[model samples]
Target: MEHTQPEQGGLRESKRRDTLQRVAQAGLELFLARGYEATTVDDISAAAGISRRTFFHYFKSKDEVLLAWQTGLVESLRQAVLQEENRQAPLDALCGALLKLAADYDSDATFAIAQLLRSNDQLRAANQVKFLQLEQAAFEALCHLWPQRRRRGRLRMVAMIGLGAFRVGIDEWTEEGGTQPFSQRIGHAFTMLRAELQVASAAAPSQ
Candidate 1:
C-alpha cells in the first residue's frame, strides 16, 4: 500500500506556496494597474481567485503582500550571514549578499513594483518601515557572525556602513533605469566608499 501521509504533506506545502505566489502576483498587478491606494484587499483576493479569508491566510494586509519580496530577501540575507561557510569579512559578506539580492530584483516585474512604491506615498512610508526592520535584522545577524565580546561596539559600525553602501547602490541602480547590472553598480559604490575611507584615514592624525 502506498503511504499517503508524505504525499499529502508535500501536496499541502506546494499548495501553500502557490497560494502565496498568487496573492503576491495579484496584489502587484492591481497596484500597478489601478494604483496602490485605489486597490483594496478585496480586489487582490478577487483577482487571485481566492476568498478574502484565504488571502488573509497568506498576508495580513495589502502592503504586506507588496513588500513580501523584500521581507523574504531580508530573512535570506540574515540566514546567509549566519551560515558557517560565509567566512568573508562582515562588510564583504553583507555587500556580496546585497549585490546578489539586487541582481534578483533586476527584472521588469520588480521595476514596476518599484515604480508603484515611488508613486505612492503611503506605500513608500510602509516600505521605509520595512527597510528599518531589515537594517536591524541585518545588524543583529552580523553581530552573530563574531563572538559576543568581539561585537560589543564594532559590528554596529560595520553594519551601518554596509547598509549605507547597499542603499546607495540600490538608489543608483534604480535611478539609472537598471541600464547597468546591479552587481557592477554595487561594486562601484563600494569602491567609492573604500576611497573615501582611505582619504579620511590618510588625513587623520597618527595616534
Candidate 2:
C-alpha cells in the first residue's frame, strides 16, 4: 500500500477552503433572500458566524462574494494553460484551457452564476464588467507564457481574438431561452472563430 505524507501547506489550504466555502454559502443565501444591494457585509458576517473584521479578511466587499467563483475559475484556467505540456504555441494552449473552463462552468457553479446575473440588473452589469476584466487577465496570462516577440504583434492579435470569442461564447451560453450547455455554446463559438480565422489567413496573402 502506498502512503502519502501530510504537508503543512496542504493543511493550510484545507483550512482556507473551508473558510471560503462557509463565507460564500452564507453570503449566497443572504443575497438570494434579502437582495444583493440590501445585504450588507454585517449581514453576511453574522450569517457566517464571523466578525466584520473576519469577513473583510476573506472578501473585500459583498459584490466580491458573487464574483469569487468567477475570479477563481479564470485564475484556474490561466494556471492550467501555463502548465500544459509542450505548449509551444500560445494559441493552442489558451484555446485548450478555455475549452476545459467551458466544461467546468457547465457544472452547478456557473449555472448558479448565470441565474444570478440574469435575475438581477445590477449583478448583470457587474458580471459583464468582471468578465471583461477576466478576458484581459486571461490575455495577459497567456502572453506571459510566450516569448516577448510573440507577444508583440500577431500573437497578441490571436490572443485578443481568442478572448473576444470566449466572451461571445459566454454571452450565448447565458442568454435567456438558450438551452445549450455552456460547454457546447463556447465550443460553437470557438468553431466559428476558427473558421473566420482560417478564412482571413487564406485571404491575407492574396490581398
Best by TM-score: 1
When summed lDDT is taken over every stretch of 10 residues in candidate 2, the lowest stretch is 1-10
Query: Candidate 2 — what's its lDDT?
Result: 0.75
In order of appearance, the predictions have TM-scores of 0.80, 0.72
* Candidate 1 local lDDT, 70-152, one digit each (tens): 75777876876676344677777777767676777777777677766666677789878866766776788877777677664
lDDT of 2 by residue, 153-180 (tens): 7656766777788888877776743578
Q: Backbone clashes in each candidate structure, one number apiece?
A: 0, 0
Poorly placed runs, candidate 2 (over 4 Å) = 1-17, 33-35, 83-89, 118-133, 140-145, 148-151, 201-207
| Model 1 residue pairs with clashes | none
What is the lDDT of every predicted structure here?
Answer: 0.78, 0.75
Q: Candidate 2: which pairs clash?
A: none
